[model samples]
Target: MVTVKMLKPYYIKADDNYVRVILAYQYFAVFINNKVYQFVPIESKEIRINRRTKKVENLGARFAFQKGKDIIYMAMSELISLPDFLVQLHSIADPYYLNKEIKSEPNYESEAIIDELEQLNMKRLIDKALDNRDYEAFQSLVKLL
Candidate 1:
């Protein structure tokens, strides 16, 4: 079962093999396997990643990123928090990105690509969700689409 934990994966280091998650607003304590790691809020919209291809052995329980730290390198990527909310809003949106992650491809039950020929007014759906206070639905669509 996949669920949004209100945490957004802001960065991933292939060399270091660490996934940095940042909270949208408050500092959330991520409890993974009994260890609690604090996530300082992310102010920037860009995804920051380390470019140096170096091996890091200490894949520890705690990783805290804050302001004033020097950015080694960054990828031109963007993702927002509240992903599950977005999914609930887009009833006819195609979920290509979500299906790509499934090990068992052709997750037919979930990922049926909606007809792109019919213009999906993404911005309108988003605005309506915001107005209706349907954040959960909005978040779901945001993560996959």
Candidate 2:
């Protein structure tokens, strides 16, 4: 029986389309029949996950990892059985999603303040143009209002 011992990603990068998870040596490991097998990315160091579907995208037919001098192969089918691994993976990716959500949310208070300031500045410019008897400048500034 295979069980995940540790699955901490070295770093995670996410965009609107996908989340890329990079793993390094000693960072991800598993246990098979109570024997530890450390995973080392051989074919590719990065795992690509679709953001919308939350599914592995770049994983080929089977992904290979190194354990000591021996290379072990794991299929996506095998990985699906381990609920703990999936849960931890999602937890690691959760922060990126939360950050995207936070960024997408509009800061209404700050936006209102900035708009008010711009209007006041434009009004001041219009008044100055009027005092200087610059009809062209006054007209342009008034148009901006």
Candidate 3:
């Protein structure tokens, strides 16, 4: 039985398409048959997950794990079967999604301020047009109002 022992990401980079979890040496570990195996990235150290679906998009071609100099190469498929692994991965990735949501949400206070400013500028322009007796400009500005 394989169980996730530790799955700490060095950093998480998220964008519209993907969330990349970069792992460093000893950052990821698992228990296989009561033995601890620490993952060592071979080809790539990053795991790419779909931002929308939250599903893993890429795991390097192969990975190496070490247990006191006894190194073993394993395919990512082996790890995907463990429910605990997915649970932990999602938990770690959830915070990045939350942060993205917080950032993407509209800032109502700032938006309100900007709208007020634009309205004030428009009113000032209309007043100026009226004072100058520019009927065409006044009519256009009033229409905008």
Please count the clashing residue pairs in each candidate, in the order shown. Answer: 17, 0, 0
Worst 10-residue lDDT window for candidate 1 reads 71-80
Model 3, span 42-71: residue lDDT tens = 656777888777778775446677898888
Note the residue pairs that clash in candidate 2. Answer: none
lDDT of 1 by residue, 1-145 (tens): 2222334434322323322222343333333334443445333332222223221222322234332352121111211123452342122122211232437666654444443422265656766888899998788656645
* lDDT of candidate model 2 versus the reference: 0.78
- After superposing candidate 3 on the true structure, give the runs of residues whose Cα lies further than 4 Å from its correct spot: 98-145
TM-score, every prediction: 0.18, 0.61, 0.63
The full ranking of all candidates by lDDT, starting with the best, is 3, 2, 1
lDDT of each: 0.36, 0.78, 0.81
RMSD of each: 24.8, 9.6, 8.2
Flag the better candidate by TM-score, 1 or 2. 2
Write model 2 residue lDDT over 1-145, tens digit each, in one string: 8888988899888888889888888888888777788876765567677886777776554556666677888876676568887888887776555333434679899999999999999999988998999999998988888
Maximum-lDDT candidate: 3
